[model samples]
Target: MDTKFDFGEPESQNTVYIRRVATSTLPEEIREQVPDLDSMYAVHDAEGEQLALVRDRSMAFVLARQNELSPVSVH
Candidate 1:
C-alpha cells in the first residue's frame, strides 16, 4: 500500500449528522427529563459536536433543515 488514502470527510460547512442516543447513556440531569423514553435523536455538526437532542428522528432532521444545515443519518 504505497498510496495514501484520504478517507476523510469532505468540507461540509452546512452539514450535520443525526443519530439515535440511548437515554441511559446521557447525564443524570438530562436523563431525568425524559425518563419515559428509552432513546432519542441527536443532531451533531461535522466536527462531531452535539447541537441538539430531540425525542424523534424526524424532529432531528427537521431541526437541521430549519437551521439551513444538511442532515445525514449516522446509522
Candidate 2:
C-alpha cells in the first residue's frame, strides 16, 4: 500500500540541510587541507546554498543550532 501525506513545504525559512560530501568532489585547494579524510559533512540552507563544510555530521547539526537554524538530513 502507498500513502501520501501532503504535509506541505518544510520550514525553509529557518531550516538547513545536512549531507555528506566526498573529498574528491571538492576543489584541489580544499582537498589538500584534509588529505587524511575521505569525506566531510556540509550544511546548506533550504534554498540549496552551502553555508559551511565540517569534518563530521554531528558538527554540522551543532553549527546549525548554534546559529538558531533547524537542521535536517538531506540524504
Candidate 3:
C-alpha cells in the first residue's frame, strides 16, 4: 500500500485536509493508528498543532466544518 500523504488544501486559518491513497493492503497497524478516517482524527503537523478530524477521501472535500461532514465508520 502506498503510504504517501497528499494534503489537499487548507480550509481555513487552522485547518488542512490530507488524503492518503493507500491500498486495501494497508497495514492493520496503520489503520489502528487512524481508526477514525471519517472523523477528525488527531494528527500532528510539522509544527505540531492539534487539528479537528474531518472526512475520508470518499468525500469531495476532506476538511469541512465539523458539522458539515458525515461520519464514516471503519471496522
Candidate 4:
C-alpha cells in the first residue's frame, strides 16, 4: 500500500465566466423575468456552473466581483 497526498488549489478558485445569451433562447419562465431586454449576460463559475443572469455585461462583472470572484469573458 502507498500513502500519497496532494494539496492543490480548488477546482473553482472563485473564477467566473461572463457571456452573452439571447433572451429568446432562454426558457419561458426565465424570459418573463427580463421582459425589457432582448439579450443578457450570464455568469458562470470555473466549473461552468451558472451563478447569475444580468441585463448587461457590466452587471455580470459587477455581480461576480461583488461575490469576491474574478470574472473573465467566455468569448
Candidate 5:
C-alpha cells in the first residue's frame, strides 16, 4: 500500500490533513448535511482550518488536489 507521513516542517502550511471523523460527533448543523453516512473524511489545512468534509478518504484527497493542496493522512 502507498502511504505518506508528514514531519510537520515549516512549509507544512501548504499541506492538507485528511482524517476520518464520526458524523455523530459533529455539530447538529454539520451532521444534518450527511445524515445517511455514519462517518466522513475531514480535510483540514495545516493551520487546522477545515477545508471540506467528504464522504470518503479518497474524495478528501481528490478535493484537496483539485484545490492545489497536498493531502496527507492523519492517523
Candidate 6:
C-alpha cells in the first residue's frame, strides 16, 4: 500500500540525527537523486527529485518541503 511521511526539520539547524536510509528507499526512477539525509532534514537531487518526494509526502518529502511544515510539526 502507498503511504505518506513527514520528515520534520533541517539538519543544519538541529542536533538530532534521523535514521540513515538507502537510495532504494525511494522510487526506483528517483532513487539515485536521494541526498545525504539527517534526522532533521533530507536533501534530494537538483533534478526535481525533491519535488516528487514532497508531492508524495514521504519523509524526504517533508525535508525537501521544509518551508511548508509548521514549526510545531517539525519538532
Off by over 4 Å in 5: 1-10
**lDDT (CA) per prediction:** 0.94, 0.94, 0.41, 0.89, 0.89, 0.38
| Worst window of 10 by summed lDDT in candidate 5 | 5-14
* Ranking of candidates on TM-score, top first: 2, 1, 4, 5, 3, 6
Candidate 2 residue-wise lDDT, 1-75, digit = tens: 589879886677899999999999999999999999999999998779899999999999999999999999988
The candidate with the higher TM-score, 3 or 4, is 4
lDDT tens digits, residues 1-75, model 4? 588878788746888899999999999998988799899999987778888988899999888889888899988
Q: Which pairs of residues collide in model 5?
A: none
Model 3 lDDT per residue over 1-75, tens place: 889988886544444344343433345665677665533333223343434332344342434334353333222
Ranking by lDDT: 2, 1, 5, 4, 3, 6
TM-score of 6: 0.22
Q: Tell me the spans in candidate 2 whose CA falls farther than 4 Å from its real position.
A: 1-10
Superior candidate under TM-score, 1 versus 3? 1
Model 4 pairs whose backbones collide = none
Give me the displacement of residue 43 in model 5, in angstroms.
Answer: 0.6
**Residue pairs with backbone overlap in model 1:** none
User: Clashes in each model (backbone N, CA, C under 3 Å)?
Assistant: 0, 0, 3, 0, 0, 2
| Highest TM-score scorer | 2
Q: Judged by lDDT, which candidate is best?
A: 2
lDDT of 1: 0.94
TM-score for each predicted model, relative to the true structure: 0.84, 0.84, 0.24, 0.79, 0.77, 0.22
Model 6: residues with Cα > 4 Å off, grouped in runs? 1-22, 35-68, 72-75
